[model samples]
Target: MAWDYKVIDGSEEKTDLGFRDEPALNHKRTRILDACKRRDIDDLQALAISRGGFLTDAIRCQAWPILLGVHVDQRGEQDGISDSWTTLKKHRDEGQVKLDVNRSFVYYPNDDTQAQLDEKKSQLSDLITEVLRRQPYLCYFQGYHDICQVFLLVLPPATRAAAVARLSALRIRDFMLPSLNPSVAQLRLIPDILRAADPTLYAHVSRTEPFFALPDTLTMFAHNVRRYSDIARLFDALLAREQAFTLYVFAQIVLRRRDELFLQDEPDMLHFTLSKLPQDLDLDALIVNTAALFERFPPESLRSWRSVSSSSTLKTVRDVSACAAQTLEDGHRFFEKHHRELIWAQRRDKVLRTAWANRALILAVVVGAGAVYFRKAPIWSNLAWSVPDHYF
Candidate 1:
């Protein structure tokens, strides 16, 4: 099947497509800022829908929370750390979070120093921990830290927590479920979306396990995209629109890469192509295509997966809160069943930390003494150990 790929000229801001030119974008920014200043939800939503998204990061920092339905009044107020954070209980998922955090350098800019990188990683862990602790029911999946780091970069700590909490409870709730069942159900929508948008591409992808969309969906494209700026641009549209809009975006990405993907008849090859996104992707064109796809196949028209509802119908913050309440109740039942196991895990972690500390101390002492003894030993005797036999 032949597809018409849109070639967007970055120099030419305006296109026959819905993309706004510089002057138009600047006008939209003015209107968006006005709407934000007034806390006008309806107007803000209107601008977001019509203009694609907020034009700048400073604007996004304000508009995103509003779009997510975060309380505007709470913007600058520091809620301090959640009480749950104070207790600092070791979560069953902490180990997984640690592993993911160690690799979160992808989110940092290349120019960032080691100290800055370390601080961001540490803060990323703390933010995720606080959110999970406050709502102990939300499961911490592998790519969650990637999603949270986006918020960490944009908002202040307290506001970042609020925004992430709102998102977890509402926008990407399925991904945070106790199991991957809800997330996989969400993943299934990608092909369904594709079938509606581009049937040939859909058929090609359907041949493979749809779980290939997992990393992009779970991480909100934080894992897939290389540039922070690009991901942020994508999120500007994402945050502005309905939660399920991501499905359309994912479909658009697959459709965009159809040429590269079609050659891979095998599922493994398809998975490899889908997993690593091109570094030089035209995000603006992708966003335009995503919006177009969503327009063609609105959520209501799409097939509903088990337990997952249409995102269009689930637009309001109230809807998200209600869903969160139910999820929390289910989580409480889960906690009750596994209470003892969690407690045991926490104790085991403490013991492991102590043992590790002791080993480090012993290693330090051994290394110090070995160094001292080696310094006093004859240089001639040390040569045998230092030099290769061939060299000798």
Candidate 2:
């Protein structure tokens, strides 16, 4: 529901950065700022990779082109044509904060020469000023919106500085990094944890007559469900529902093992192992498989085949060797399943009520207009009721 990083500061050796170190920190921040001034995302990225602190990842990401490749390939789609152009206008009119990249990005084509690039970079220095000032909020800043553009959209000119300082100092990015997704890393542990939680069901599922791991999950539980249209939106809708309930249980497991997962364990290597080559592993199998660690009836829920269906009532508990049990669905309210409809219904009701309230006001406005134009109106039009009954 909310980002956790804004609260959790990175692990650091020293708590205090007193007067003597302030100048050096400023010098380092300044050197990167200066290089950014020179239209050198290249140098800026190098400085980021070389440094290791809270801001390191942000610096590396912003300057990734320099770290990964020289050409700075256009890998992602630019937002939209009109949208892209309008952004520059908004920045000029609203952002007020200067960036080192604006004019260069706007006037010169992206395929421009070196000198034009440098000029644009000078204009865009406001970007650094903006981020350095807002220090705490940067990491949770959504992608697709340029941090500069978002600043203009959300904050007034005065508040912009403090917002960017909050952004640059945010630890949100650590949890959001490609490798560090906690859900994926903890998924594999689901099966083992489930085995520990309920050994009999684990044994039944493992060595019994009717046992099957989720068929589609090849590498650590990635789903390969049949895609019916442009996307597997239907499956995702189901996954979302089940996942809501799953997170409630998984949080319990993860919280109990917080020391092992987030603290004591080797974070870097753990990230690589859990993550796949192209994309990371999934959490579903672990959750579902852990669900399977309970004694299941016919074991059909884990299978994607709707053609061969069965119902399951087995619910696993926290303790080991506990018998599979059924928790009644009576009075159970699963929010994720019906949330969209609930939201739509609420909105529709609100709109209807608002419209009903507005109608009397609309009628009064009409009566006022009629009174204002009373002189111009034909007497017959106003006196229609006087003659209408006799005519009828």
Return the top candidate by TM-score.
1
After superposition, candidate 1 runs with Cα above 4 Å error: 1-25, 49-52, 72-75, 78-84, 304-392
Model 1: which residue pairs collide?
A: none
Query: Whose lDDT is greatest here?
Result: 1
Kindly give the stretch of ten consecutive residues in candidate 2 with the minimal lDDT sum: 323-332
TM-score of each: 0.70, 0.18
CA displacement after TM-score superposition, residue 112 of candidate 2 (Å): 39
Task: List ranges where model 2 is wrong by over 4 Å.
Answer: 1-20, 50-392
lDDT of 1 by residue, 1-392 (tens): 11112212111122222443556656677899998887676676556545345655577778877766565444465333334464856667888888998999674455677887898889988888877777766688888888888788767654788778767766666566554655666677888888887888888888787887888877888887776566766787777666677777888888888888889999888888887767877776777778788788876676754335323123322232233234333434434444444455569989989878799787899999998888778984686578887885
TM-score of candidate 2 on Cα atoms, chains taken together: 0.18
Backbone clashes, each candidate: 0, 23
lDDT of each residue in 1-392, candidate 2, tens digit only? 11111111122212221224455656665676566446453354334323221122233223322211112225432111113222332222224333223432332123446774554354335544434332221122222123333233223333433333322222112222223222232233334443555554334333321112211121111122211110111122111122223322332233233343333234444333222222221333333443344334222233222221111101211211111111111101111222334365569989999988898998899999988787567884677656767588
- Measured on C-alpha atoms, candidate 1 has an lDDT of 0.68
